[model samples]
Target: MLVAGCSHFAGRRPLLGYSDKGVQHADTAIVACAEQLQYVCGITGVNQISTWEKFNGGKTPWVRVLPGRQVIRMTLSNSRQLNRQDVIIDNVQAGHVYRIDVGSSGTLLTATYTDLGKLDSYTIHMPRFPLEPKAITASF
Candidate 1:
């Protein structure tokens, strides 16, 4: 069970349309779900992505796509309602981030798509391996 859990964790990847070597940071657009407003159940052209994390610490559900007209199918839900919406994002600019907000207004579920501007900053974590020299002994 422990090994299975570790394997599952290691196999997870972001639901990105382009390959890591093919995508340039400056030319990629990001779409993220607003965790406070709604939960994203799935994304189009990809497997269902989990938007929640342990202790609510999971990074928001986001995908990186080429800058262009993109159709995103989302299953959004709130405390009172659940909705499946097909959101058309047109003319997405490179280096920009878009956020989807779904909420209830007067008993009506509304989804708002907002462009949050360019991605400000990002961090990458890598494991470091130690390099040690073996002890050498000389005989007389």
Candidate 2:
């Protein structure tokens, strides 16, 4: 019952062009979603949710769960070659629908939960170039 999705950057564009900045926008979106989930749903403990960047050579950022368990680990790294597209990011959810966005520089991982037939969603924003834990804030 694991859900997953991913996206990546392709082709070249001017450094300051819109296409080049798509990654940044995608990162922002992910961060926004995570915040919404945390604040709106009161989800405190986020166990291991896989992020796409881990596919590359990087240390996945993990969250500590109840007692002492790191559940979610998201990793990101730069590509070795200019033409080589780095593994942007991935979203993995167990028994839930995971909506993910893999941008050039970041990843947006979201999970939709169903409890007693009630639907709930949670999200996290992960950077693809370097693993840094940013504060999750609500989008609304």
lDDT of 1 by residue, 45-120 (tens): 3223233333212332556667778776666665676666666788888877777777667666666679978765
- Compared with the true structure, all predictions reach lDDT values of 0.53, 0.24
So what's the TM-score on candidate 1? 0.58
Tell me the tens digit of each residue's lDDT in model 2 across 11-130. 011111112333432222111112231222111123323332323222222221122222222332224211112222233222222232223423432333222111133334443233
The TM-score measured for candidate 2 stands at 0.17
Which regions of candidate 1 deviate over 4 angstroms? Answer: 1-13, 18-21, 37-42, 45-60, 105-108, 122-140
Clashes of 2: 11
lDDT of 2 at 114: 21
The residue-level lDDT of candidate 2 at 34 comes to 24
Q: Which portions of model 2 show Cα errors greater than 4 Å? A: 1-71, 80-94, 105-140
